[model samples]
Target: MARILIVDDAKFMRVTLSNILQKGDHEIVGEAENGTQAIQLFEELSPDLVTMDITMPEMNGLDALKAIKNKAPQAKIIMCSAMGQQKMVVEAIEAGAKDFIVKPFEESRVLEAINRVLG
Candidate 1:
């Protein structure tokens, strides 16, 4: 099972993700409400994977993804975005996100993306 850090501005999103990941048998190492906190947690926890929200207060996911990658090129990150954020998703992929999941997430898709990235 992978150790994961979940980052989202909404508490609901974080809880939803945590439930899905825990059900998948992955360990949730930490959760962050914004990019700044995400970055700090990433350094502290060094989780196997990260689920990062794109639009967040304090720093934003794209910037956080870039920062994490800069610090650790092998860091495995997956961008989480809402509908109509395809452009941001693309940018995230280019910036080194392993994959992405749309909001209002589906359990199967979430697990699929996590497994794919972890593999």
Candidate 2:
């Protein structure tokens, strides 16, 4: 199972993602409320994968994604975006996100993205 870090400003979103991932048998290494915390936890935990929310306070996911990728070129990051953020999603992919899941996440899609990225 992949060790995963979930980053989002909403506690509900984080918990929801955690539940879905746990059900998929992936370990939740850590959770972060914003990009800054995400970056800090990323370095500290070195999780196998990260699910990063596109819009967040403190810093945004794209910036954090870039930072993480810069530090660890092989980092596996999956961008989490709400509907209507297609532009950001494209940017995320170009920035090295392995995959992306739109908000109001479905369990199947989340697991699919994780599996594809981990593979």
Candidate 3:
């Protein structure tokens, strides 16, 4: 099981993803509501992976992803967005995210991305 950090402004989204990850048997090292918190948690927790929401208050996921990658080049991140955020997803991939999952996440897809990134 991977140690994962979840970052999303919405509490519901964070809970949903947490349930899914728990079902998959991954450990949730931390949860953050925005980019700033995410970066700080990442530095402290050093989780194996992160599921990052694209749009958030304070700082956006893309910026946070860049920040985390700068801190740890090998950090594994999966961008999460709603249906219309493909442009940002692409930018995330370019910025070095291992993969992405759309909001209202699918169980199989989320696990798949995790496995692929871990593999």
Per-candidate TM-scores read 0.99, 0.99, 0.98
Instruction: Write down the lDDT that model 1 would get.
Output: 0.97
Candidate 3, 62-96: lDDT as tens digits: 99999999989999999999999899999999999
lDDT of 1 by residue, 13-88 (tens): 9999999999999999999999999999999999999999999988999999999999999999999999999999
Each candidate's root-mean-square deviation in Å? 0.4, 0.5, 0.6
Alpha-carbon shift of residue 15 in model 1 (angstroms): 0.4
| Candidate 3 segments exceeding 4 Å error | none
Candidate scoring better on lDDT of 1 and 3: 1
lDDT, candidate 2, 1-119, per-residue tens: 99999999999999999999999999999999999999999999999999999999999999999999999999999999999999999999999999999889999999998999999
Q: Rate the local accuracy (lDDT) of all candidates.
A: 0.97, 0.97, 0.95
Q: Give the deviation of candidate 3 from the true structure as CA RMSD.
A: 0.6
In candidate 3, list every pair of residues with a backbone clash: none
